[model samples]
Target: MKFALVDDIKTEAVKGAKGICPSCGSEMIARCGNFKINHWAHKGRRKCDPWWENETIWHRSWKNNYPIEWQEISLLDEKTGEKHIADIQANDGLVIEFQHSYINPEERFSREKFYKKMVWVVDGTRLKKDYPRFMKGKSDFITTNKPGIFKVDFPDECFPYAWLESSVPVVFDFGKLFESISGISNPMYCLFPKHENYYALIAEINRKTFIKTTLNGEWLSRTEEFLKQSKKTKLNRTFIQPIENTIRRKPSKYVLERGKWKKRRRF
Candidate 1:
């Protein structure tokens, strides 16, 4: 949604600029409103892509972090002949989607399948109750052997359940606007889904760093660095350690109630 084709070249939205949609080749007009961020819209107010969502400041902020070439890339599936524009398709085929709105589980699964290697950057502060629910769910978190990596025993009760069973990794932006922070130091939490539990990897570097590492296949090395750094204060029982110790000693259990998990009462 950020870029349209002007004079057969990808162009950013500017006031009074007329262009064409790169995806559907439809006529587009630049919308530079006082209240909303400037963007391109189909001339007839029609949607070319059914999967497209209304762009927000949150989405634009994330897209601006990457290079212009990498933003709004059109990907085609040779096998299925399906085409879609990725929010960001890194140099190494890693698709990063910045999601601010709610989506059903089916669509989430379909997107994950289409993009074999991808990561989701969700806006966790979208709803008023999101942060409070996540805070409550944190009580059931357990740290993993990998520093900054934690396991949530019951993920269904968490804030973003749409991606709970996502095959790819997911990073949550707790509405911590990344305006002033450098790309490499943007703090985020990565979630990796397993059979019944979800592993949460705390961001050591900024969002940019994580993306670079993942693109270069250096994520394992990054995890190692965090593990070694975590040991220096192992004795002091810092933030990650205590949870790791607690889970190591006695893992908590939950019961399914009305499609959600309820922490079992301990005697």
Candidate 2:
């Protein structure tokens, strides 16, 4: 963990420092070794929370982007007496989890329920195969009326299987920090929760924009608006388009796949 309680104050890990776990109030000893980044370890390294994952440089970078006080917040559920440390619980009550390790679908669902209002910032570059799969799937993206929004026929092809059914928005960060030219060439992509069975909605998100909006508490509202607009788009295409406009038009470009003409739908 990045921060621990020393003298009842949040402090970063330092060699020879002994502190208390902010979440479980257990003894924490700072380990400043050559292998991993300096971090506080629980007594005997017995993890107090099963949900907690080992932190990496990427995780530390994301946590440091927000304010110090917001990083590694301890949250509790009064009803279940459940407690866990959140990576970042924004001032606006939005939890931003920076996930680098794999999480099973059941545990993923449990976290979503715990942090009802949350956003997942997944490390897409963790596995070499991840970004390549997304690039392959990107060629099939169906453009939407909204500039940065797209309709994905098969989201599983582009994103990690764990995130396809996320209750909250999951943003994949495929860029290697300091390696890109502009963010650099890799911008984050957000896969929205399931909307329609036929396709999934995705948005190209700018990293800076996401951080600013989240800090000012606009993230939730903006996400809700996007969800509503997607529903409207589906409704318009299904029922609101004029009958003449829906008629099949002369095909300028067509491809046959599995006995169906791709791109045959009226735009």
Candidate 3:
């Protein structure tokens, strides 16, 4: 983990430093090496939390974008007595989990359920095939009426299958900020939770804008409002589809006017 409890305060790992794990209150010893980023380790390499994973340079770099106080937050479920350390919990109770390694579908779903109001910032550069597949699928991205928002037929073709069924927003970071690809600016793509007509919704969000809105707590509210409105729109479409289909297949061009059926013949 990035931060541990030292002197009753959250502190980063330093060489030969001893601290306490913020979540479990276990003894933590700092190990600073050239190979790995400086981090606190439990005795005998045992982990207090089962869900804890090794941090990567990409993960640490993303964490640095947010404030130190917001990083490595420990959350507990009072009813179930479940406790886990979140990567970042914003001021407005939004959890941001920066994932750089591969995770199975079950664990991913579990994390989403635990962090109800959360977003996943996945590192897309981890796997070579992932970026290529996404680029290939980008050709099929249908433009929506809304700016920067797109409609995708099969999101599984573009993103990892594990994330296609996520319950919250999943933001895929293809490259670091200022990293250009094919001479074009690389922006993070966010996949929304809901899908309509098997068409997934993805938004091309600027990295800086994502960070800014997320920091100021606008991202959560905006996402909630969008999902709410999307649900209404989808219901309206579903309700109107049958009527439109029936009218198209009616075969007879007749209209009820003045209590009598008026017929018109096709030419």
Candidate with best TM-score: 2
Quantify all predictions' global Cα lDDT against the true fold: 0.69, 0.79, 0.79
State model 1's lDDT. 0.69
Question: Model 1: per-residue lDDT, tens digit, 1-267?
Answer: 789999999898999999999988999999998898999999987987767898999899878877888888888899898998899887767788888999898898899899877778888789888777776665556544544455554554455656655666677777454331213345666665333222333432366676667567576454446545644433122443333233332443655454344567888
Clashes of each: 2, 0, 0
lDDT of 2 by residue, 1-267 (tens): 888899999999999999999998899999899999999999895897889999999999888789999999999999999988899998889999999999998999999999999999999888889888887666666655555667755566678767777888999898643332123244688888855546677788778888889889999999988787666657233322221223333332333344222444556
| Model 2 TM-score on a 0 to 1 scale | 0.84
Q: Which pairs in model 2 have colliding backbones?
A: none
Task: Tell me the lDDT of candidate 3.
Answer: 0.79
Estimate the TM-score of every prediction. Answer: 0.76, 0.84, 0.83
Superior by TM-score: candidate 2 or candidate 3: 2
Error of 3 at 251 (Å): 33
Please identify model 3 stretches exceeding 4 Å from their true place: 176-185, 234-267
Residue by residue across 1-267, what tens digits does model 3's lDDT show?
888889989988999898999888889899899999988888677787777889989889889999999998899999999998899999999999998888897898899999899999998878889888887666666665555667765566678877877889999998853433223355889998787765778888888889999999899999999889887765332222111122122233443234222354566
Which residue segments of model 2 deviate by more than 4 Å? 176-186, 235-267
List where candidate 1 sits over 4 angstroms from the true fold.
Answer: 177-186, 196-205, 214-267
Model 3 TM-score, 2 decimals? 0.83
